[model samples]
Target: MKLYWSSRSPFVRKVMVFAHECGLAERIVCVRTVVAMTKPNVDLLPVNPTGKIPTLLLDDGSALYDSAVICEYLDSLHGGPRLFPESGPARWTALRRHALGNNLTDNLMLWRNETLRPQPQQSPEILAAFELKVRNAVAALEHEAAALAADPVSIGHVAIACALGYIDFRFAALDWRTGHDRIARWYETFARRPSMVLTAHVDQ
Candidate 1:
């Protein structure tokens, strides 16, 4: 398997973290690919029309994009407790947390793009809205951190951690730990996981 990867992408980190947990990290060959929303990378166009990173080129000659799908696929290949529960309430909870995490990350990334735009083209209103959204999301996580911290490690946990990591990497000025004490404390330990320690995001 081949993965079009970017060290700076949290989405890519999710997949890599999943791979590491599943003990399949050594099997995939990572091909570094630079990509930006406004500036597309031609090399990725042939394989993934969206020119996205973390695109998986499977050995069977097929491809899979999106961290959610790729992580589930990798989880399926493993034998231990599934990152994605196969059914019932556990499945729903995992999916819900995972979605919330992804959504939080999406808004943050968009907020970041807005900041990168020329000052004249940037929308202060949009940035403010997302900043509020992130604050509320972190507040909600503070309530759930105690439970999430005591886990067998679900894919949802992976998503949430990656989302938080992205904030620290790009929006450090936000200081997300302000009042979300439990979540902050939990993250202090979660961030030390070998998978996270190894795949820590890098700007360049």
Candidate 2:
């Protein structure tokens, strides 16, 4: 399998972290693919019209896009414990947590794009809204920190960690760890996992 990957994308990191956790990392060939909001990658459009990184190219000439979809596919390939629970309350909880984390990541990316615009073009209202949402999300995570630590690791955990990791990577000025001690402590341990340590973000 080949993955259109970028060192800076949190979504891509989510998938890579999942792959590593499932012991599928070595099977994937990471092909550095650069993409940006303003400038799309024409070469990538042929394979993934959205021109998104983390698009997976299968050996049979097929493709899968979206981190969540690619992650479920990889989970199917592995025989060990599943990151996505198969049924019942566990499944719902994991999916809900994944949604929360994924949405937070989306907002952070948007916040980043907004910040990148020339100051005159940036929207103060949008920036403020993003900041508020991020704060709310972090507080929610802090409340769930104990549950997260007690549960078996899931895709939810991976997504949340990636989201937090992205903040550290791009929004360090936010200093998210200040009051969210529980979640911050949870992340400190989660970030040490081999998957995270191996795929740490790079600016370029």
**Models, CA RMSD each:** 0.9, 0.5
What's the lDDT for residue 164 in model 2? 99
Against the true structure, candidate 1 has what lDDT?
A: 0.91
Among residues 3 or more apart in sequence or in different chains, the pairs in candidate 2 whose N, CA or C atoms overlap within 3 Å are none
Q: Top TM-score: which candidate number?
A: 2
Q: Estimate each model's TM-score.
A: 0.97, 0.99
Per-model lDDT: 0.91, 0.97
Consecutive 10-residue window with the lowest summed lDDT within model 1? 146-155
Q: In candidate 2, what are the lDDT values of residues 89-192, reduced to their tens digit?
A: 99999999999999999999999999999999999999999999999999999999999999999999999999999999999999999999999999999999
Instruction: Give me the overall lDDT of model 2.
Output: 0.97
Top model number, lDDT: 2
Q: Residue 114 error for model 2, in Å?
A: 0.5
lDDT accuracy of residue 164 in candidate 1: 97
